[model samples]
Target: MKVTITSIELKGPFKFFALSYRAMHILRQLKATNCLAMKKRGYWIKHYTMTLWKSEQDLKKFAMSGAHLAAMKASKSLAKEIRTITYEADSLPDWPTAEIMLKKAHVIHY
Candidate 1:
């Protein structure tokens, strides 16, 4: 499976609800796709998500279109920082392991 982890730190407390609204849209879209599993955790001003897919191509396909694409574009302003990591995995790991991988993920600047 292709496992991807993403984390976001908001610029202000006010932005969390905005991000949550967008997240809801994306999560709704996710159900119609080929994604295997999805999970999320939040702490303070940060939010994290983990997703499982059949391949990186499948993941990219979802990202490059529709509500997700719009949310990603909007997130640049709503987030103080955003980071993501992608790798192969035989099975989904527990949230603790996923959080560690997210912590080690490279930062992305938009």
Candidate 2:
């Protein structure tokens, strides 16, 4: 199976609890509409979000879909900003669990 992972790095100071809540909201919203898996980590207030998609088309569809587009646009308006890079994996490879997915994703960026 193919997996598309999105790695996001937040640009400013953001309360962890608040961002986590927002992340959950975003993930739930995406999961309701598409096949999506999400994870997050931090570094000096910088944060990373990894979203797994079944395919590039699936990923694109969610990105261009109305609610997602609105949420992403709204995120930019917040004091914190984020940069994301999407990666394609032909297979899960060495990842045995979702945790592995997060570790592998952390090692990859555009």
Candidate 3:
């Protein structure tokens, strides 16, 4: 399985709520094999999402199209920082393991 973990920091409370709503919407509509969303402790504007896919191509197809693409474009200005990590896994990892992997994983900043 291909797993992806993403973290995003929004500019303010309004942006955080707006983006959080959109993220939840996307999670419901996501085509990935498995997905989860969580809020970082002590940070109202910080959020994380983990998703597992059958292949990188499948992940890209979902990310590059529909509501996900629209959200990505819209967040360009609203997000203060964005980081993501993608790697192959034999099975879905628990949330704690996912967090550890994210810390060690090379990040893409935006």
Candidate 4:
């Protein structure tokens, strides 16, 4: 399946909690056939999230959807600035079985 690795660096003094909530709302509206956490790392108390998708089209559709669009419009008003790197992957490999994936990833276990 296709995948998109979005690395977002949030600007300081931003409403991180609210923006995070909005991001989840946008992800929830995505029509992707499947989604999974890829890799995640954080520095300086900021947050980083990696999510896999069925295809670029599916992800782009969500980016253009209302919730995301509204968030984008507020980028300037944000307490933190944001930067995103979107990579369009041709194929993704090494997805473990559901049980294994669930058991291994702390956040996904629930």
Candidate 5:
């Protein structure tokens, strides 16, 4: 399986509502894209996602298209910081495990 974990800190509280709208689209698309499992955590300015897929290809297919694509385009503008990690795994990590991995992962400061 392939696991992807992402963490985003919005620039401000207001950005959460904006991102939430886009997130709705992403959730709908995720189901259709054959994601094996997914989880989200955090509140207000902070948000995170841990997703499981059969392969990297399946994950990329959902990420690079649809509302997710739009969200990516808005990321630099909407978020204060973003962190991401992708790796081959036997299963999706729990929120705490994902958070631990994210600490050493790539980060973008907006």
Candidate 6:
């Protein structure tokens, strides 16, 4: 299994609001995608998503297309920090493990 984890910190209330609105749509789109498991964490300006996929290609396909792609573009300006990590796993990692992995992941600042 391929696991991907993402973390985002919104710039402010307005950016948060805008992204939250788009997030609703992206969540729905994720649910309909080929991911094996999807989980969301955090609230307010901080948010994280942990997803399990059959392959890296499947995750790339989703990330590069449709709502996910749109969200990525929109977030570049609205987010204060963005980070992600991907690894191969035999099964979905627990929330604690996911969080630790995210903390160790490299971050990008906008």
- Best by the TM-score measure: 5
Arranged by lDDT with the best first, the candidates are 5, 1, 6, 3, 2, 4
Task: Write one digit per residue (lDDT tens) for candidate 1, span 65-101.
Answer: 9889998889888888899998999677787887788
Candidate lDDT values, in order = 0.87, 0.55, 0.70, 0.50, 0.90, 0.86
List runs of model 4 lying over 4 Å from the truth.
7-14, 31-45, 88-110
Candidate 3 vs candidate 5: which has greater TM-score?
Answer: 5
Q: What would the per-residue lDDT of candidate 2 be over residues 30-100, giving only the tens digit for each residue? A: 77755645555665655655566678787777777665676566565442444444566644333235434
Candidate 6, 5-104: lDDT as tens digits = 9889988766777887888988888878888988887788888888899999899988998888998888888899999999999677788888789888
- Better-scoring candidate (TM-score), 1 or 5: 5
C-alpha positional error of residue 16 in candidate 3 after TM-score superposition, expressed in Å: 2.1
Per-candidate TM-scores read 0.91, 0.55, 0.75, 0.52, 0.95, 0.90
Pairs that collide in candidate 4 are 11-80, 11-81, 13-79, 14-79, 14-80
Candidate 6 clash pair list: none
Better of 3 and 5 by lDDT: 5
Clashes of each: 0, 0, 0, 5, 0, 0
Native-to-model Cα distance after best TM-score fit, residue 92 in candidate 5, in Å: 1.2
- Choose 4 or 5, whichever is better by TM-score: 5
Residue lDDT tens for model 3, 1-110: 67787777778767866886777767656834334322233257777777777778878888887778889888876788777788888566676876777777655445
Candidate 3 ranges beyond 4 A from true positions: 31-43, 104-110
Candidate 2, 32: how far from true, in Å? 2.1
In model 4, the Cα lDDT at residue 72 comes to 67
| Model 5 bad stretches (over 4 Å) | none
lDDT for residue 24 in candidate 4, whole number 0-100 = 75
